[model samples]
Target: MKIACLQFNPKLGEIEKNQNFASGLLESYKPGDIDILVLPEMAFTGYMFKSKEHIKPYLEDAETGITIRWAKAQAIRLRSFVMVGYPQIVKGNPDIYYNSICFIGRDGELIETYSKHFLYTTDESWANEGPEFKAINVDSLGKVGFGICMDLNRYQFKAPFDVYEFADFHLQQRTKIVLCSMAWLSNNDNYNDNDNNHEISTINYWCNRLSPLILNNNNDIGNILVVVCNRTGIEDSTTFAGSSSILSISPSTGSVHLLGSLGKRQESIMIIDVPIDDDT
Candidate 1:
């Protein structure tokens, strides 16, 4: 199966612009050539939504909403599964919202919706935290795990870590791909007077450090493909350094291969062919 990750800068609160951007990227790919297309978290609206009242109108319902309808149409047209992130209001409390990733199948079906299991400290003011880690089965792709930005940090905990515990529990279920949708920000505060370090070291310190560690640990347990889709550019005071990538792991040896990366904070679609092991 082939996969594509879109890395681009999103305009804050500009739904039309961001949707158009995603549409254009989707149009560039050939139908059936790519099995899955992953997009970054809150791609429609920038990371900081200010408040529920401010973003209420932009929240989408996965079943019959315009965004999902458009995405499903695109998925059907491209014959590829699409994983997109957006803000969604909870049914009971209409006022409360959840950071969600919606999956659209190649057949124009709304496959699954995974709410972000871990909420960022900054997001607690507006978004409700998700309680469980959900995995979906995508026929040709085996079972796939979905996670948002802060959910990756769940691994930082020592005992009974949310992500690690989730991974341990799910390992027996035979998942193939672990997909993450993120709006990764570069740490500009740490760039003061570190002239002694190499340029690569400085870059890696802020941008690329956590990814390899996450991929390495995941690869060791099961041969899973780790794909991260991140947005670029600056929103409010935060600057995003786009480094979206795909890493493939060998089940037997746990060796990782760098499939691809989009190094700039510009619009890009990265495609890579992923071979499925029949033995699994």
Candidate 2:
């Protein structure tokens, strides 16, 4: 299946302008061009808001608002599934909001809405944490999983050192692809404070964080695909890491490898294909 991962920068609080930018990229491809197209977290409603009120105007009802409408419109035009992130007004509780992702099917149907189950400190002031993990089935894609930026890094402990959270879904489930919408910051974003230890690239951070699935050394059917679409450019004190990547493990060797990368600071629409096994 061919997947397009769009990595671009978004202006803070300018929903109309940002939607146009994202829409332009979606319009660049035609129908039957790709199986799925994934955009960055808060694709239109940029991250780094100063307060909850600052983002209030952009929050939409998770299922039928502007973001969903846009996704439905684009999915209809492209004849493919679309995954994007936007500020979501909780369905049953309108007073609550979350940083979330939505999956719009090729037939212009809303398939799923996944809230960020784990929140970063920066998000706490404006967003609520989601309650559960999720996996869904798409026509040609098989079972797929969803996660936002911080959801992938939900570590169990950070007391003195660090302890990783266990992610065992892929081993037992039929999920073939996992999609992550991110606005990941570059490590060097903290350089002004003179912390030399914070120089690792976010791509390295992602590769390591995905060890539970990619490091399938002893597991069979190891070819699970992880598609990440992250934003670029600097937002306030944070410079987002833009190395959107598509990585996978080789079924033959059970070793992890990079299938594609959009690089660190460029705005791009990367099209990569993942071979689907007949059995899957």
Candidate 3:
């Protein structure tokens, strides 16, 4: 199966513009080409909102949100699975919201909705922490895990996140693929989206983090694939990492490689075929 990741820039609070841009992107592709399509975190809404009130205009209920409606329509039209991130105002009287990802199946059915587990301090003011992650099985994709940007980082609000380690968790679940959505901002002045070196290092950093769990000599998790959809461009002076990519690791052979990638700061849909038998 071929999976496509979308890397793009979104302006603050310009939901309609972003939606149109994303819609136009899908229009260029035939539905049967890609099995799954992933978009960056808050793909339509800019990620730098100061408060919940500041972003309320873009928030919608997970069940009936216009964002999910668009995704459902796209999935039905393209005959592919679609996953995108947006702020979800959970349906309730208290009006609770979270940084969330919604997955729509090929038949336009709501598959699964995941809230972000790890959040930055800045996110604490408006967003709530999410539930513990567990991999799920899709129609075509086998065992799959879902995650967000900060969830990759070992820390949560400056502290080590869960009690269990990353390796143990995935190993037990035997999750073969992880679909991730990210708005990975580069706050360091030393690094920007223009530098491919920094972007490569960032990928390397993730590889290193997963080394112990999926691609090491001691482990037996075969053919683990991590597919990332990260945002690009600057939002409120913070530049996002645009080197959205796929990393495949065959634990039996202990070999890891980049399957496909988009250029740093480029807006494009990258598609890569997955060799079912290869375990990196």
Best by lDDT: 3
Q: Rate the local accuracy (lDDT) of all candidates.
A: 0.71, 0.78, 0.80
Q: Candidate 1 residues 1-280, lDDT tens each?
A: 7889988778988888888988887776678778888999988877877777777778877677666777788898889898889888766678668889889988989889888877776567678877788777778777888878877654433444333544443455555788889886664423222222222332343223233333444444556677888877777777665667787655555355667777645577888887766322
Report the C-alpha displacement of residue 214, candidate 3, in angstroms.
2.9
Which residue pairs overlap in candidate 2's backbone?
none
**Candidate 2 lDDT, 117-150, residue by residue in tens:** 8787778888888887688887777889998888
Against the hidden reference, what TM-scores do the models get? 0.83, 0.89, 0.91
Off by over 4 Å in 2: 156-166, 190-200, 278-280
Q: Arrange candidates by TM-score, highest first: which order?
A: 3, 2, 1
Which regions of candidate 3 deviate over 4 angstroms?
Answer: 157-167, 187-198, 216-220, 278-280
List the candidates ranked by lDDT, beginning with the highest.
Answer: 3, 2, 1
Clashes of each: 0, 0, 3
What lDDT score goes with residue 101 in model 2? 91
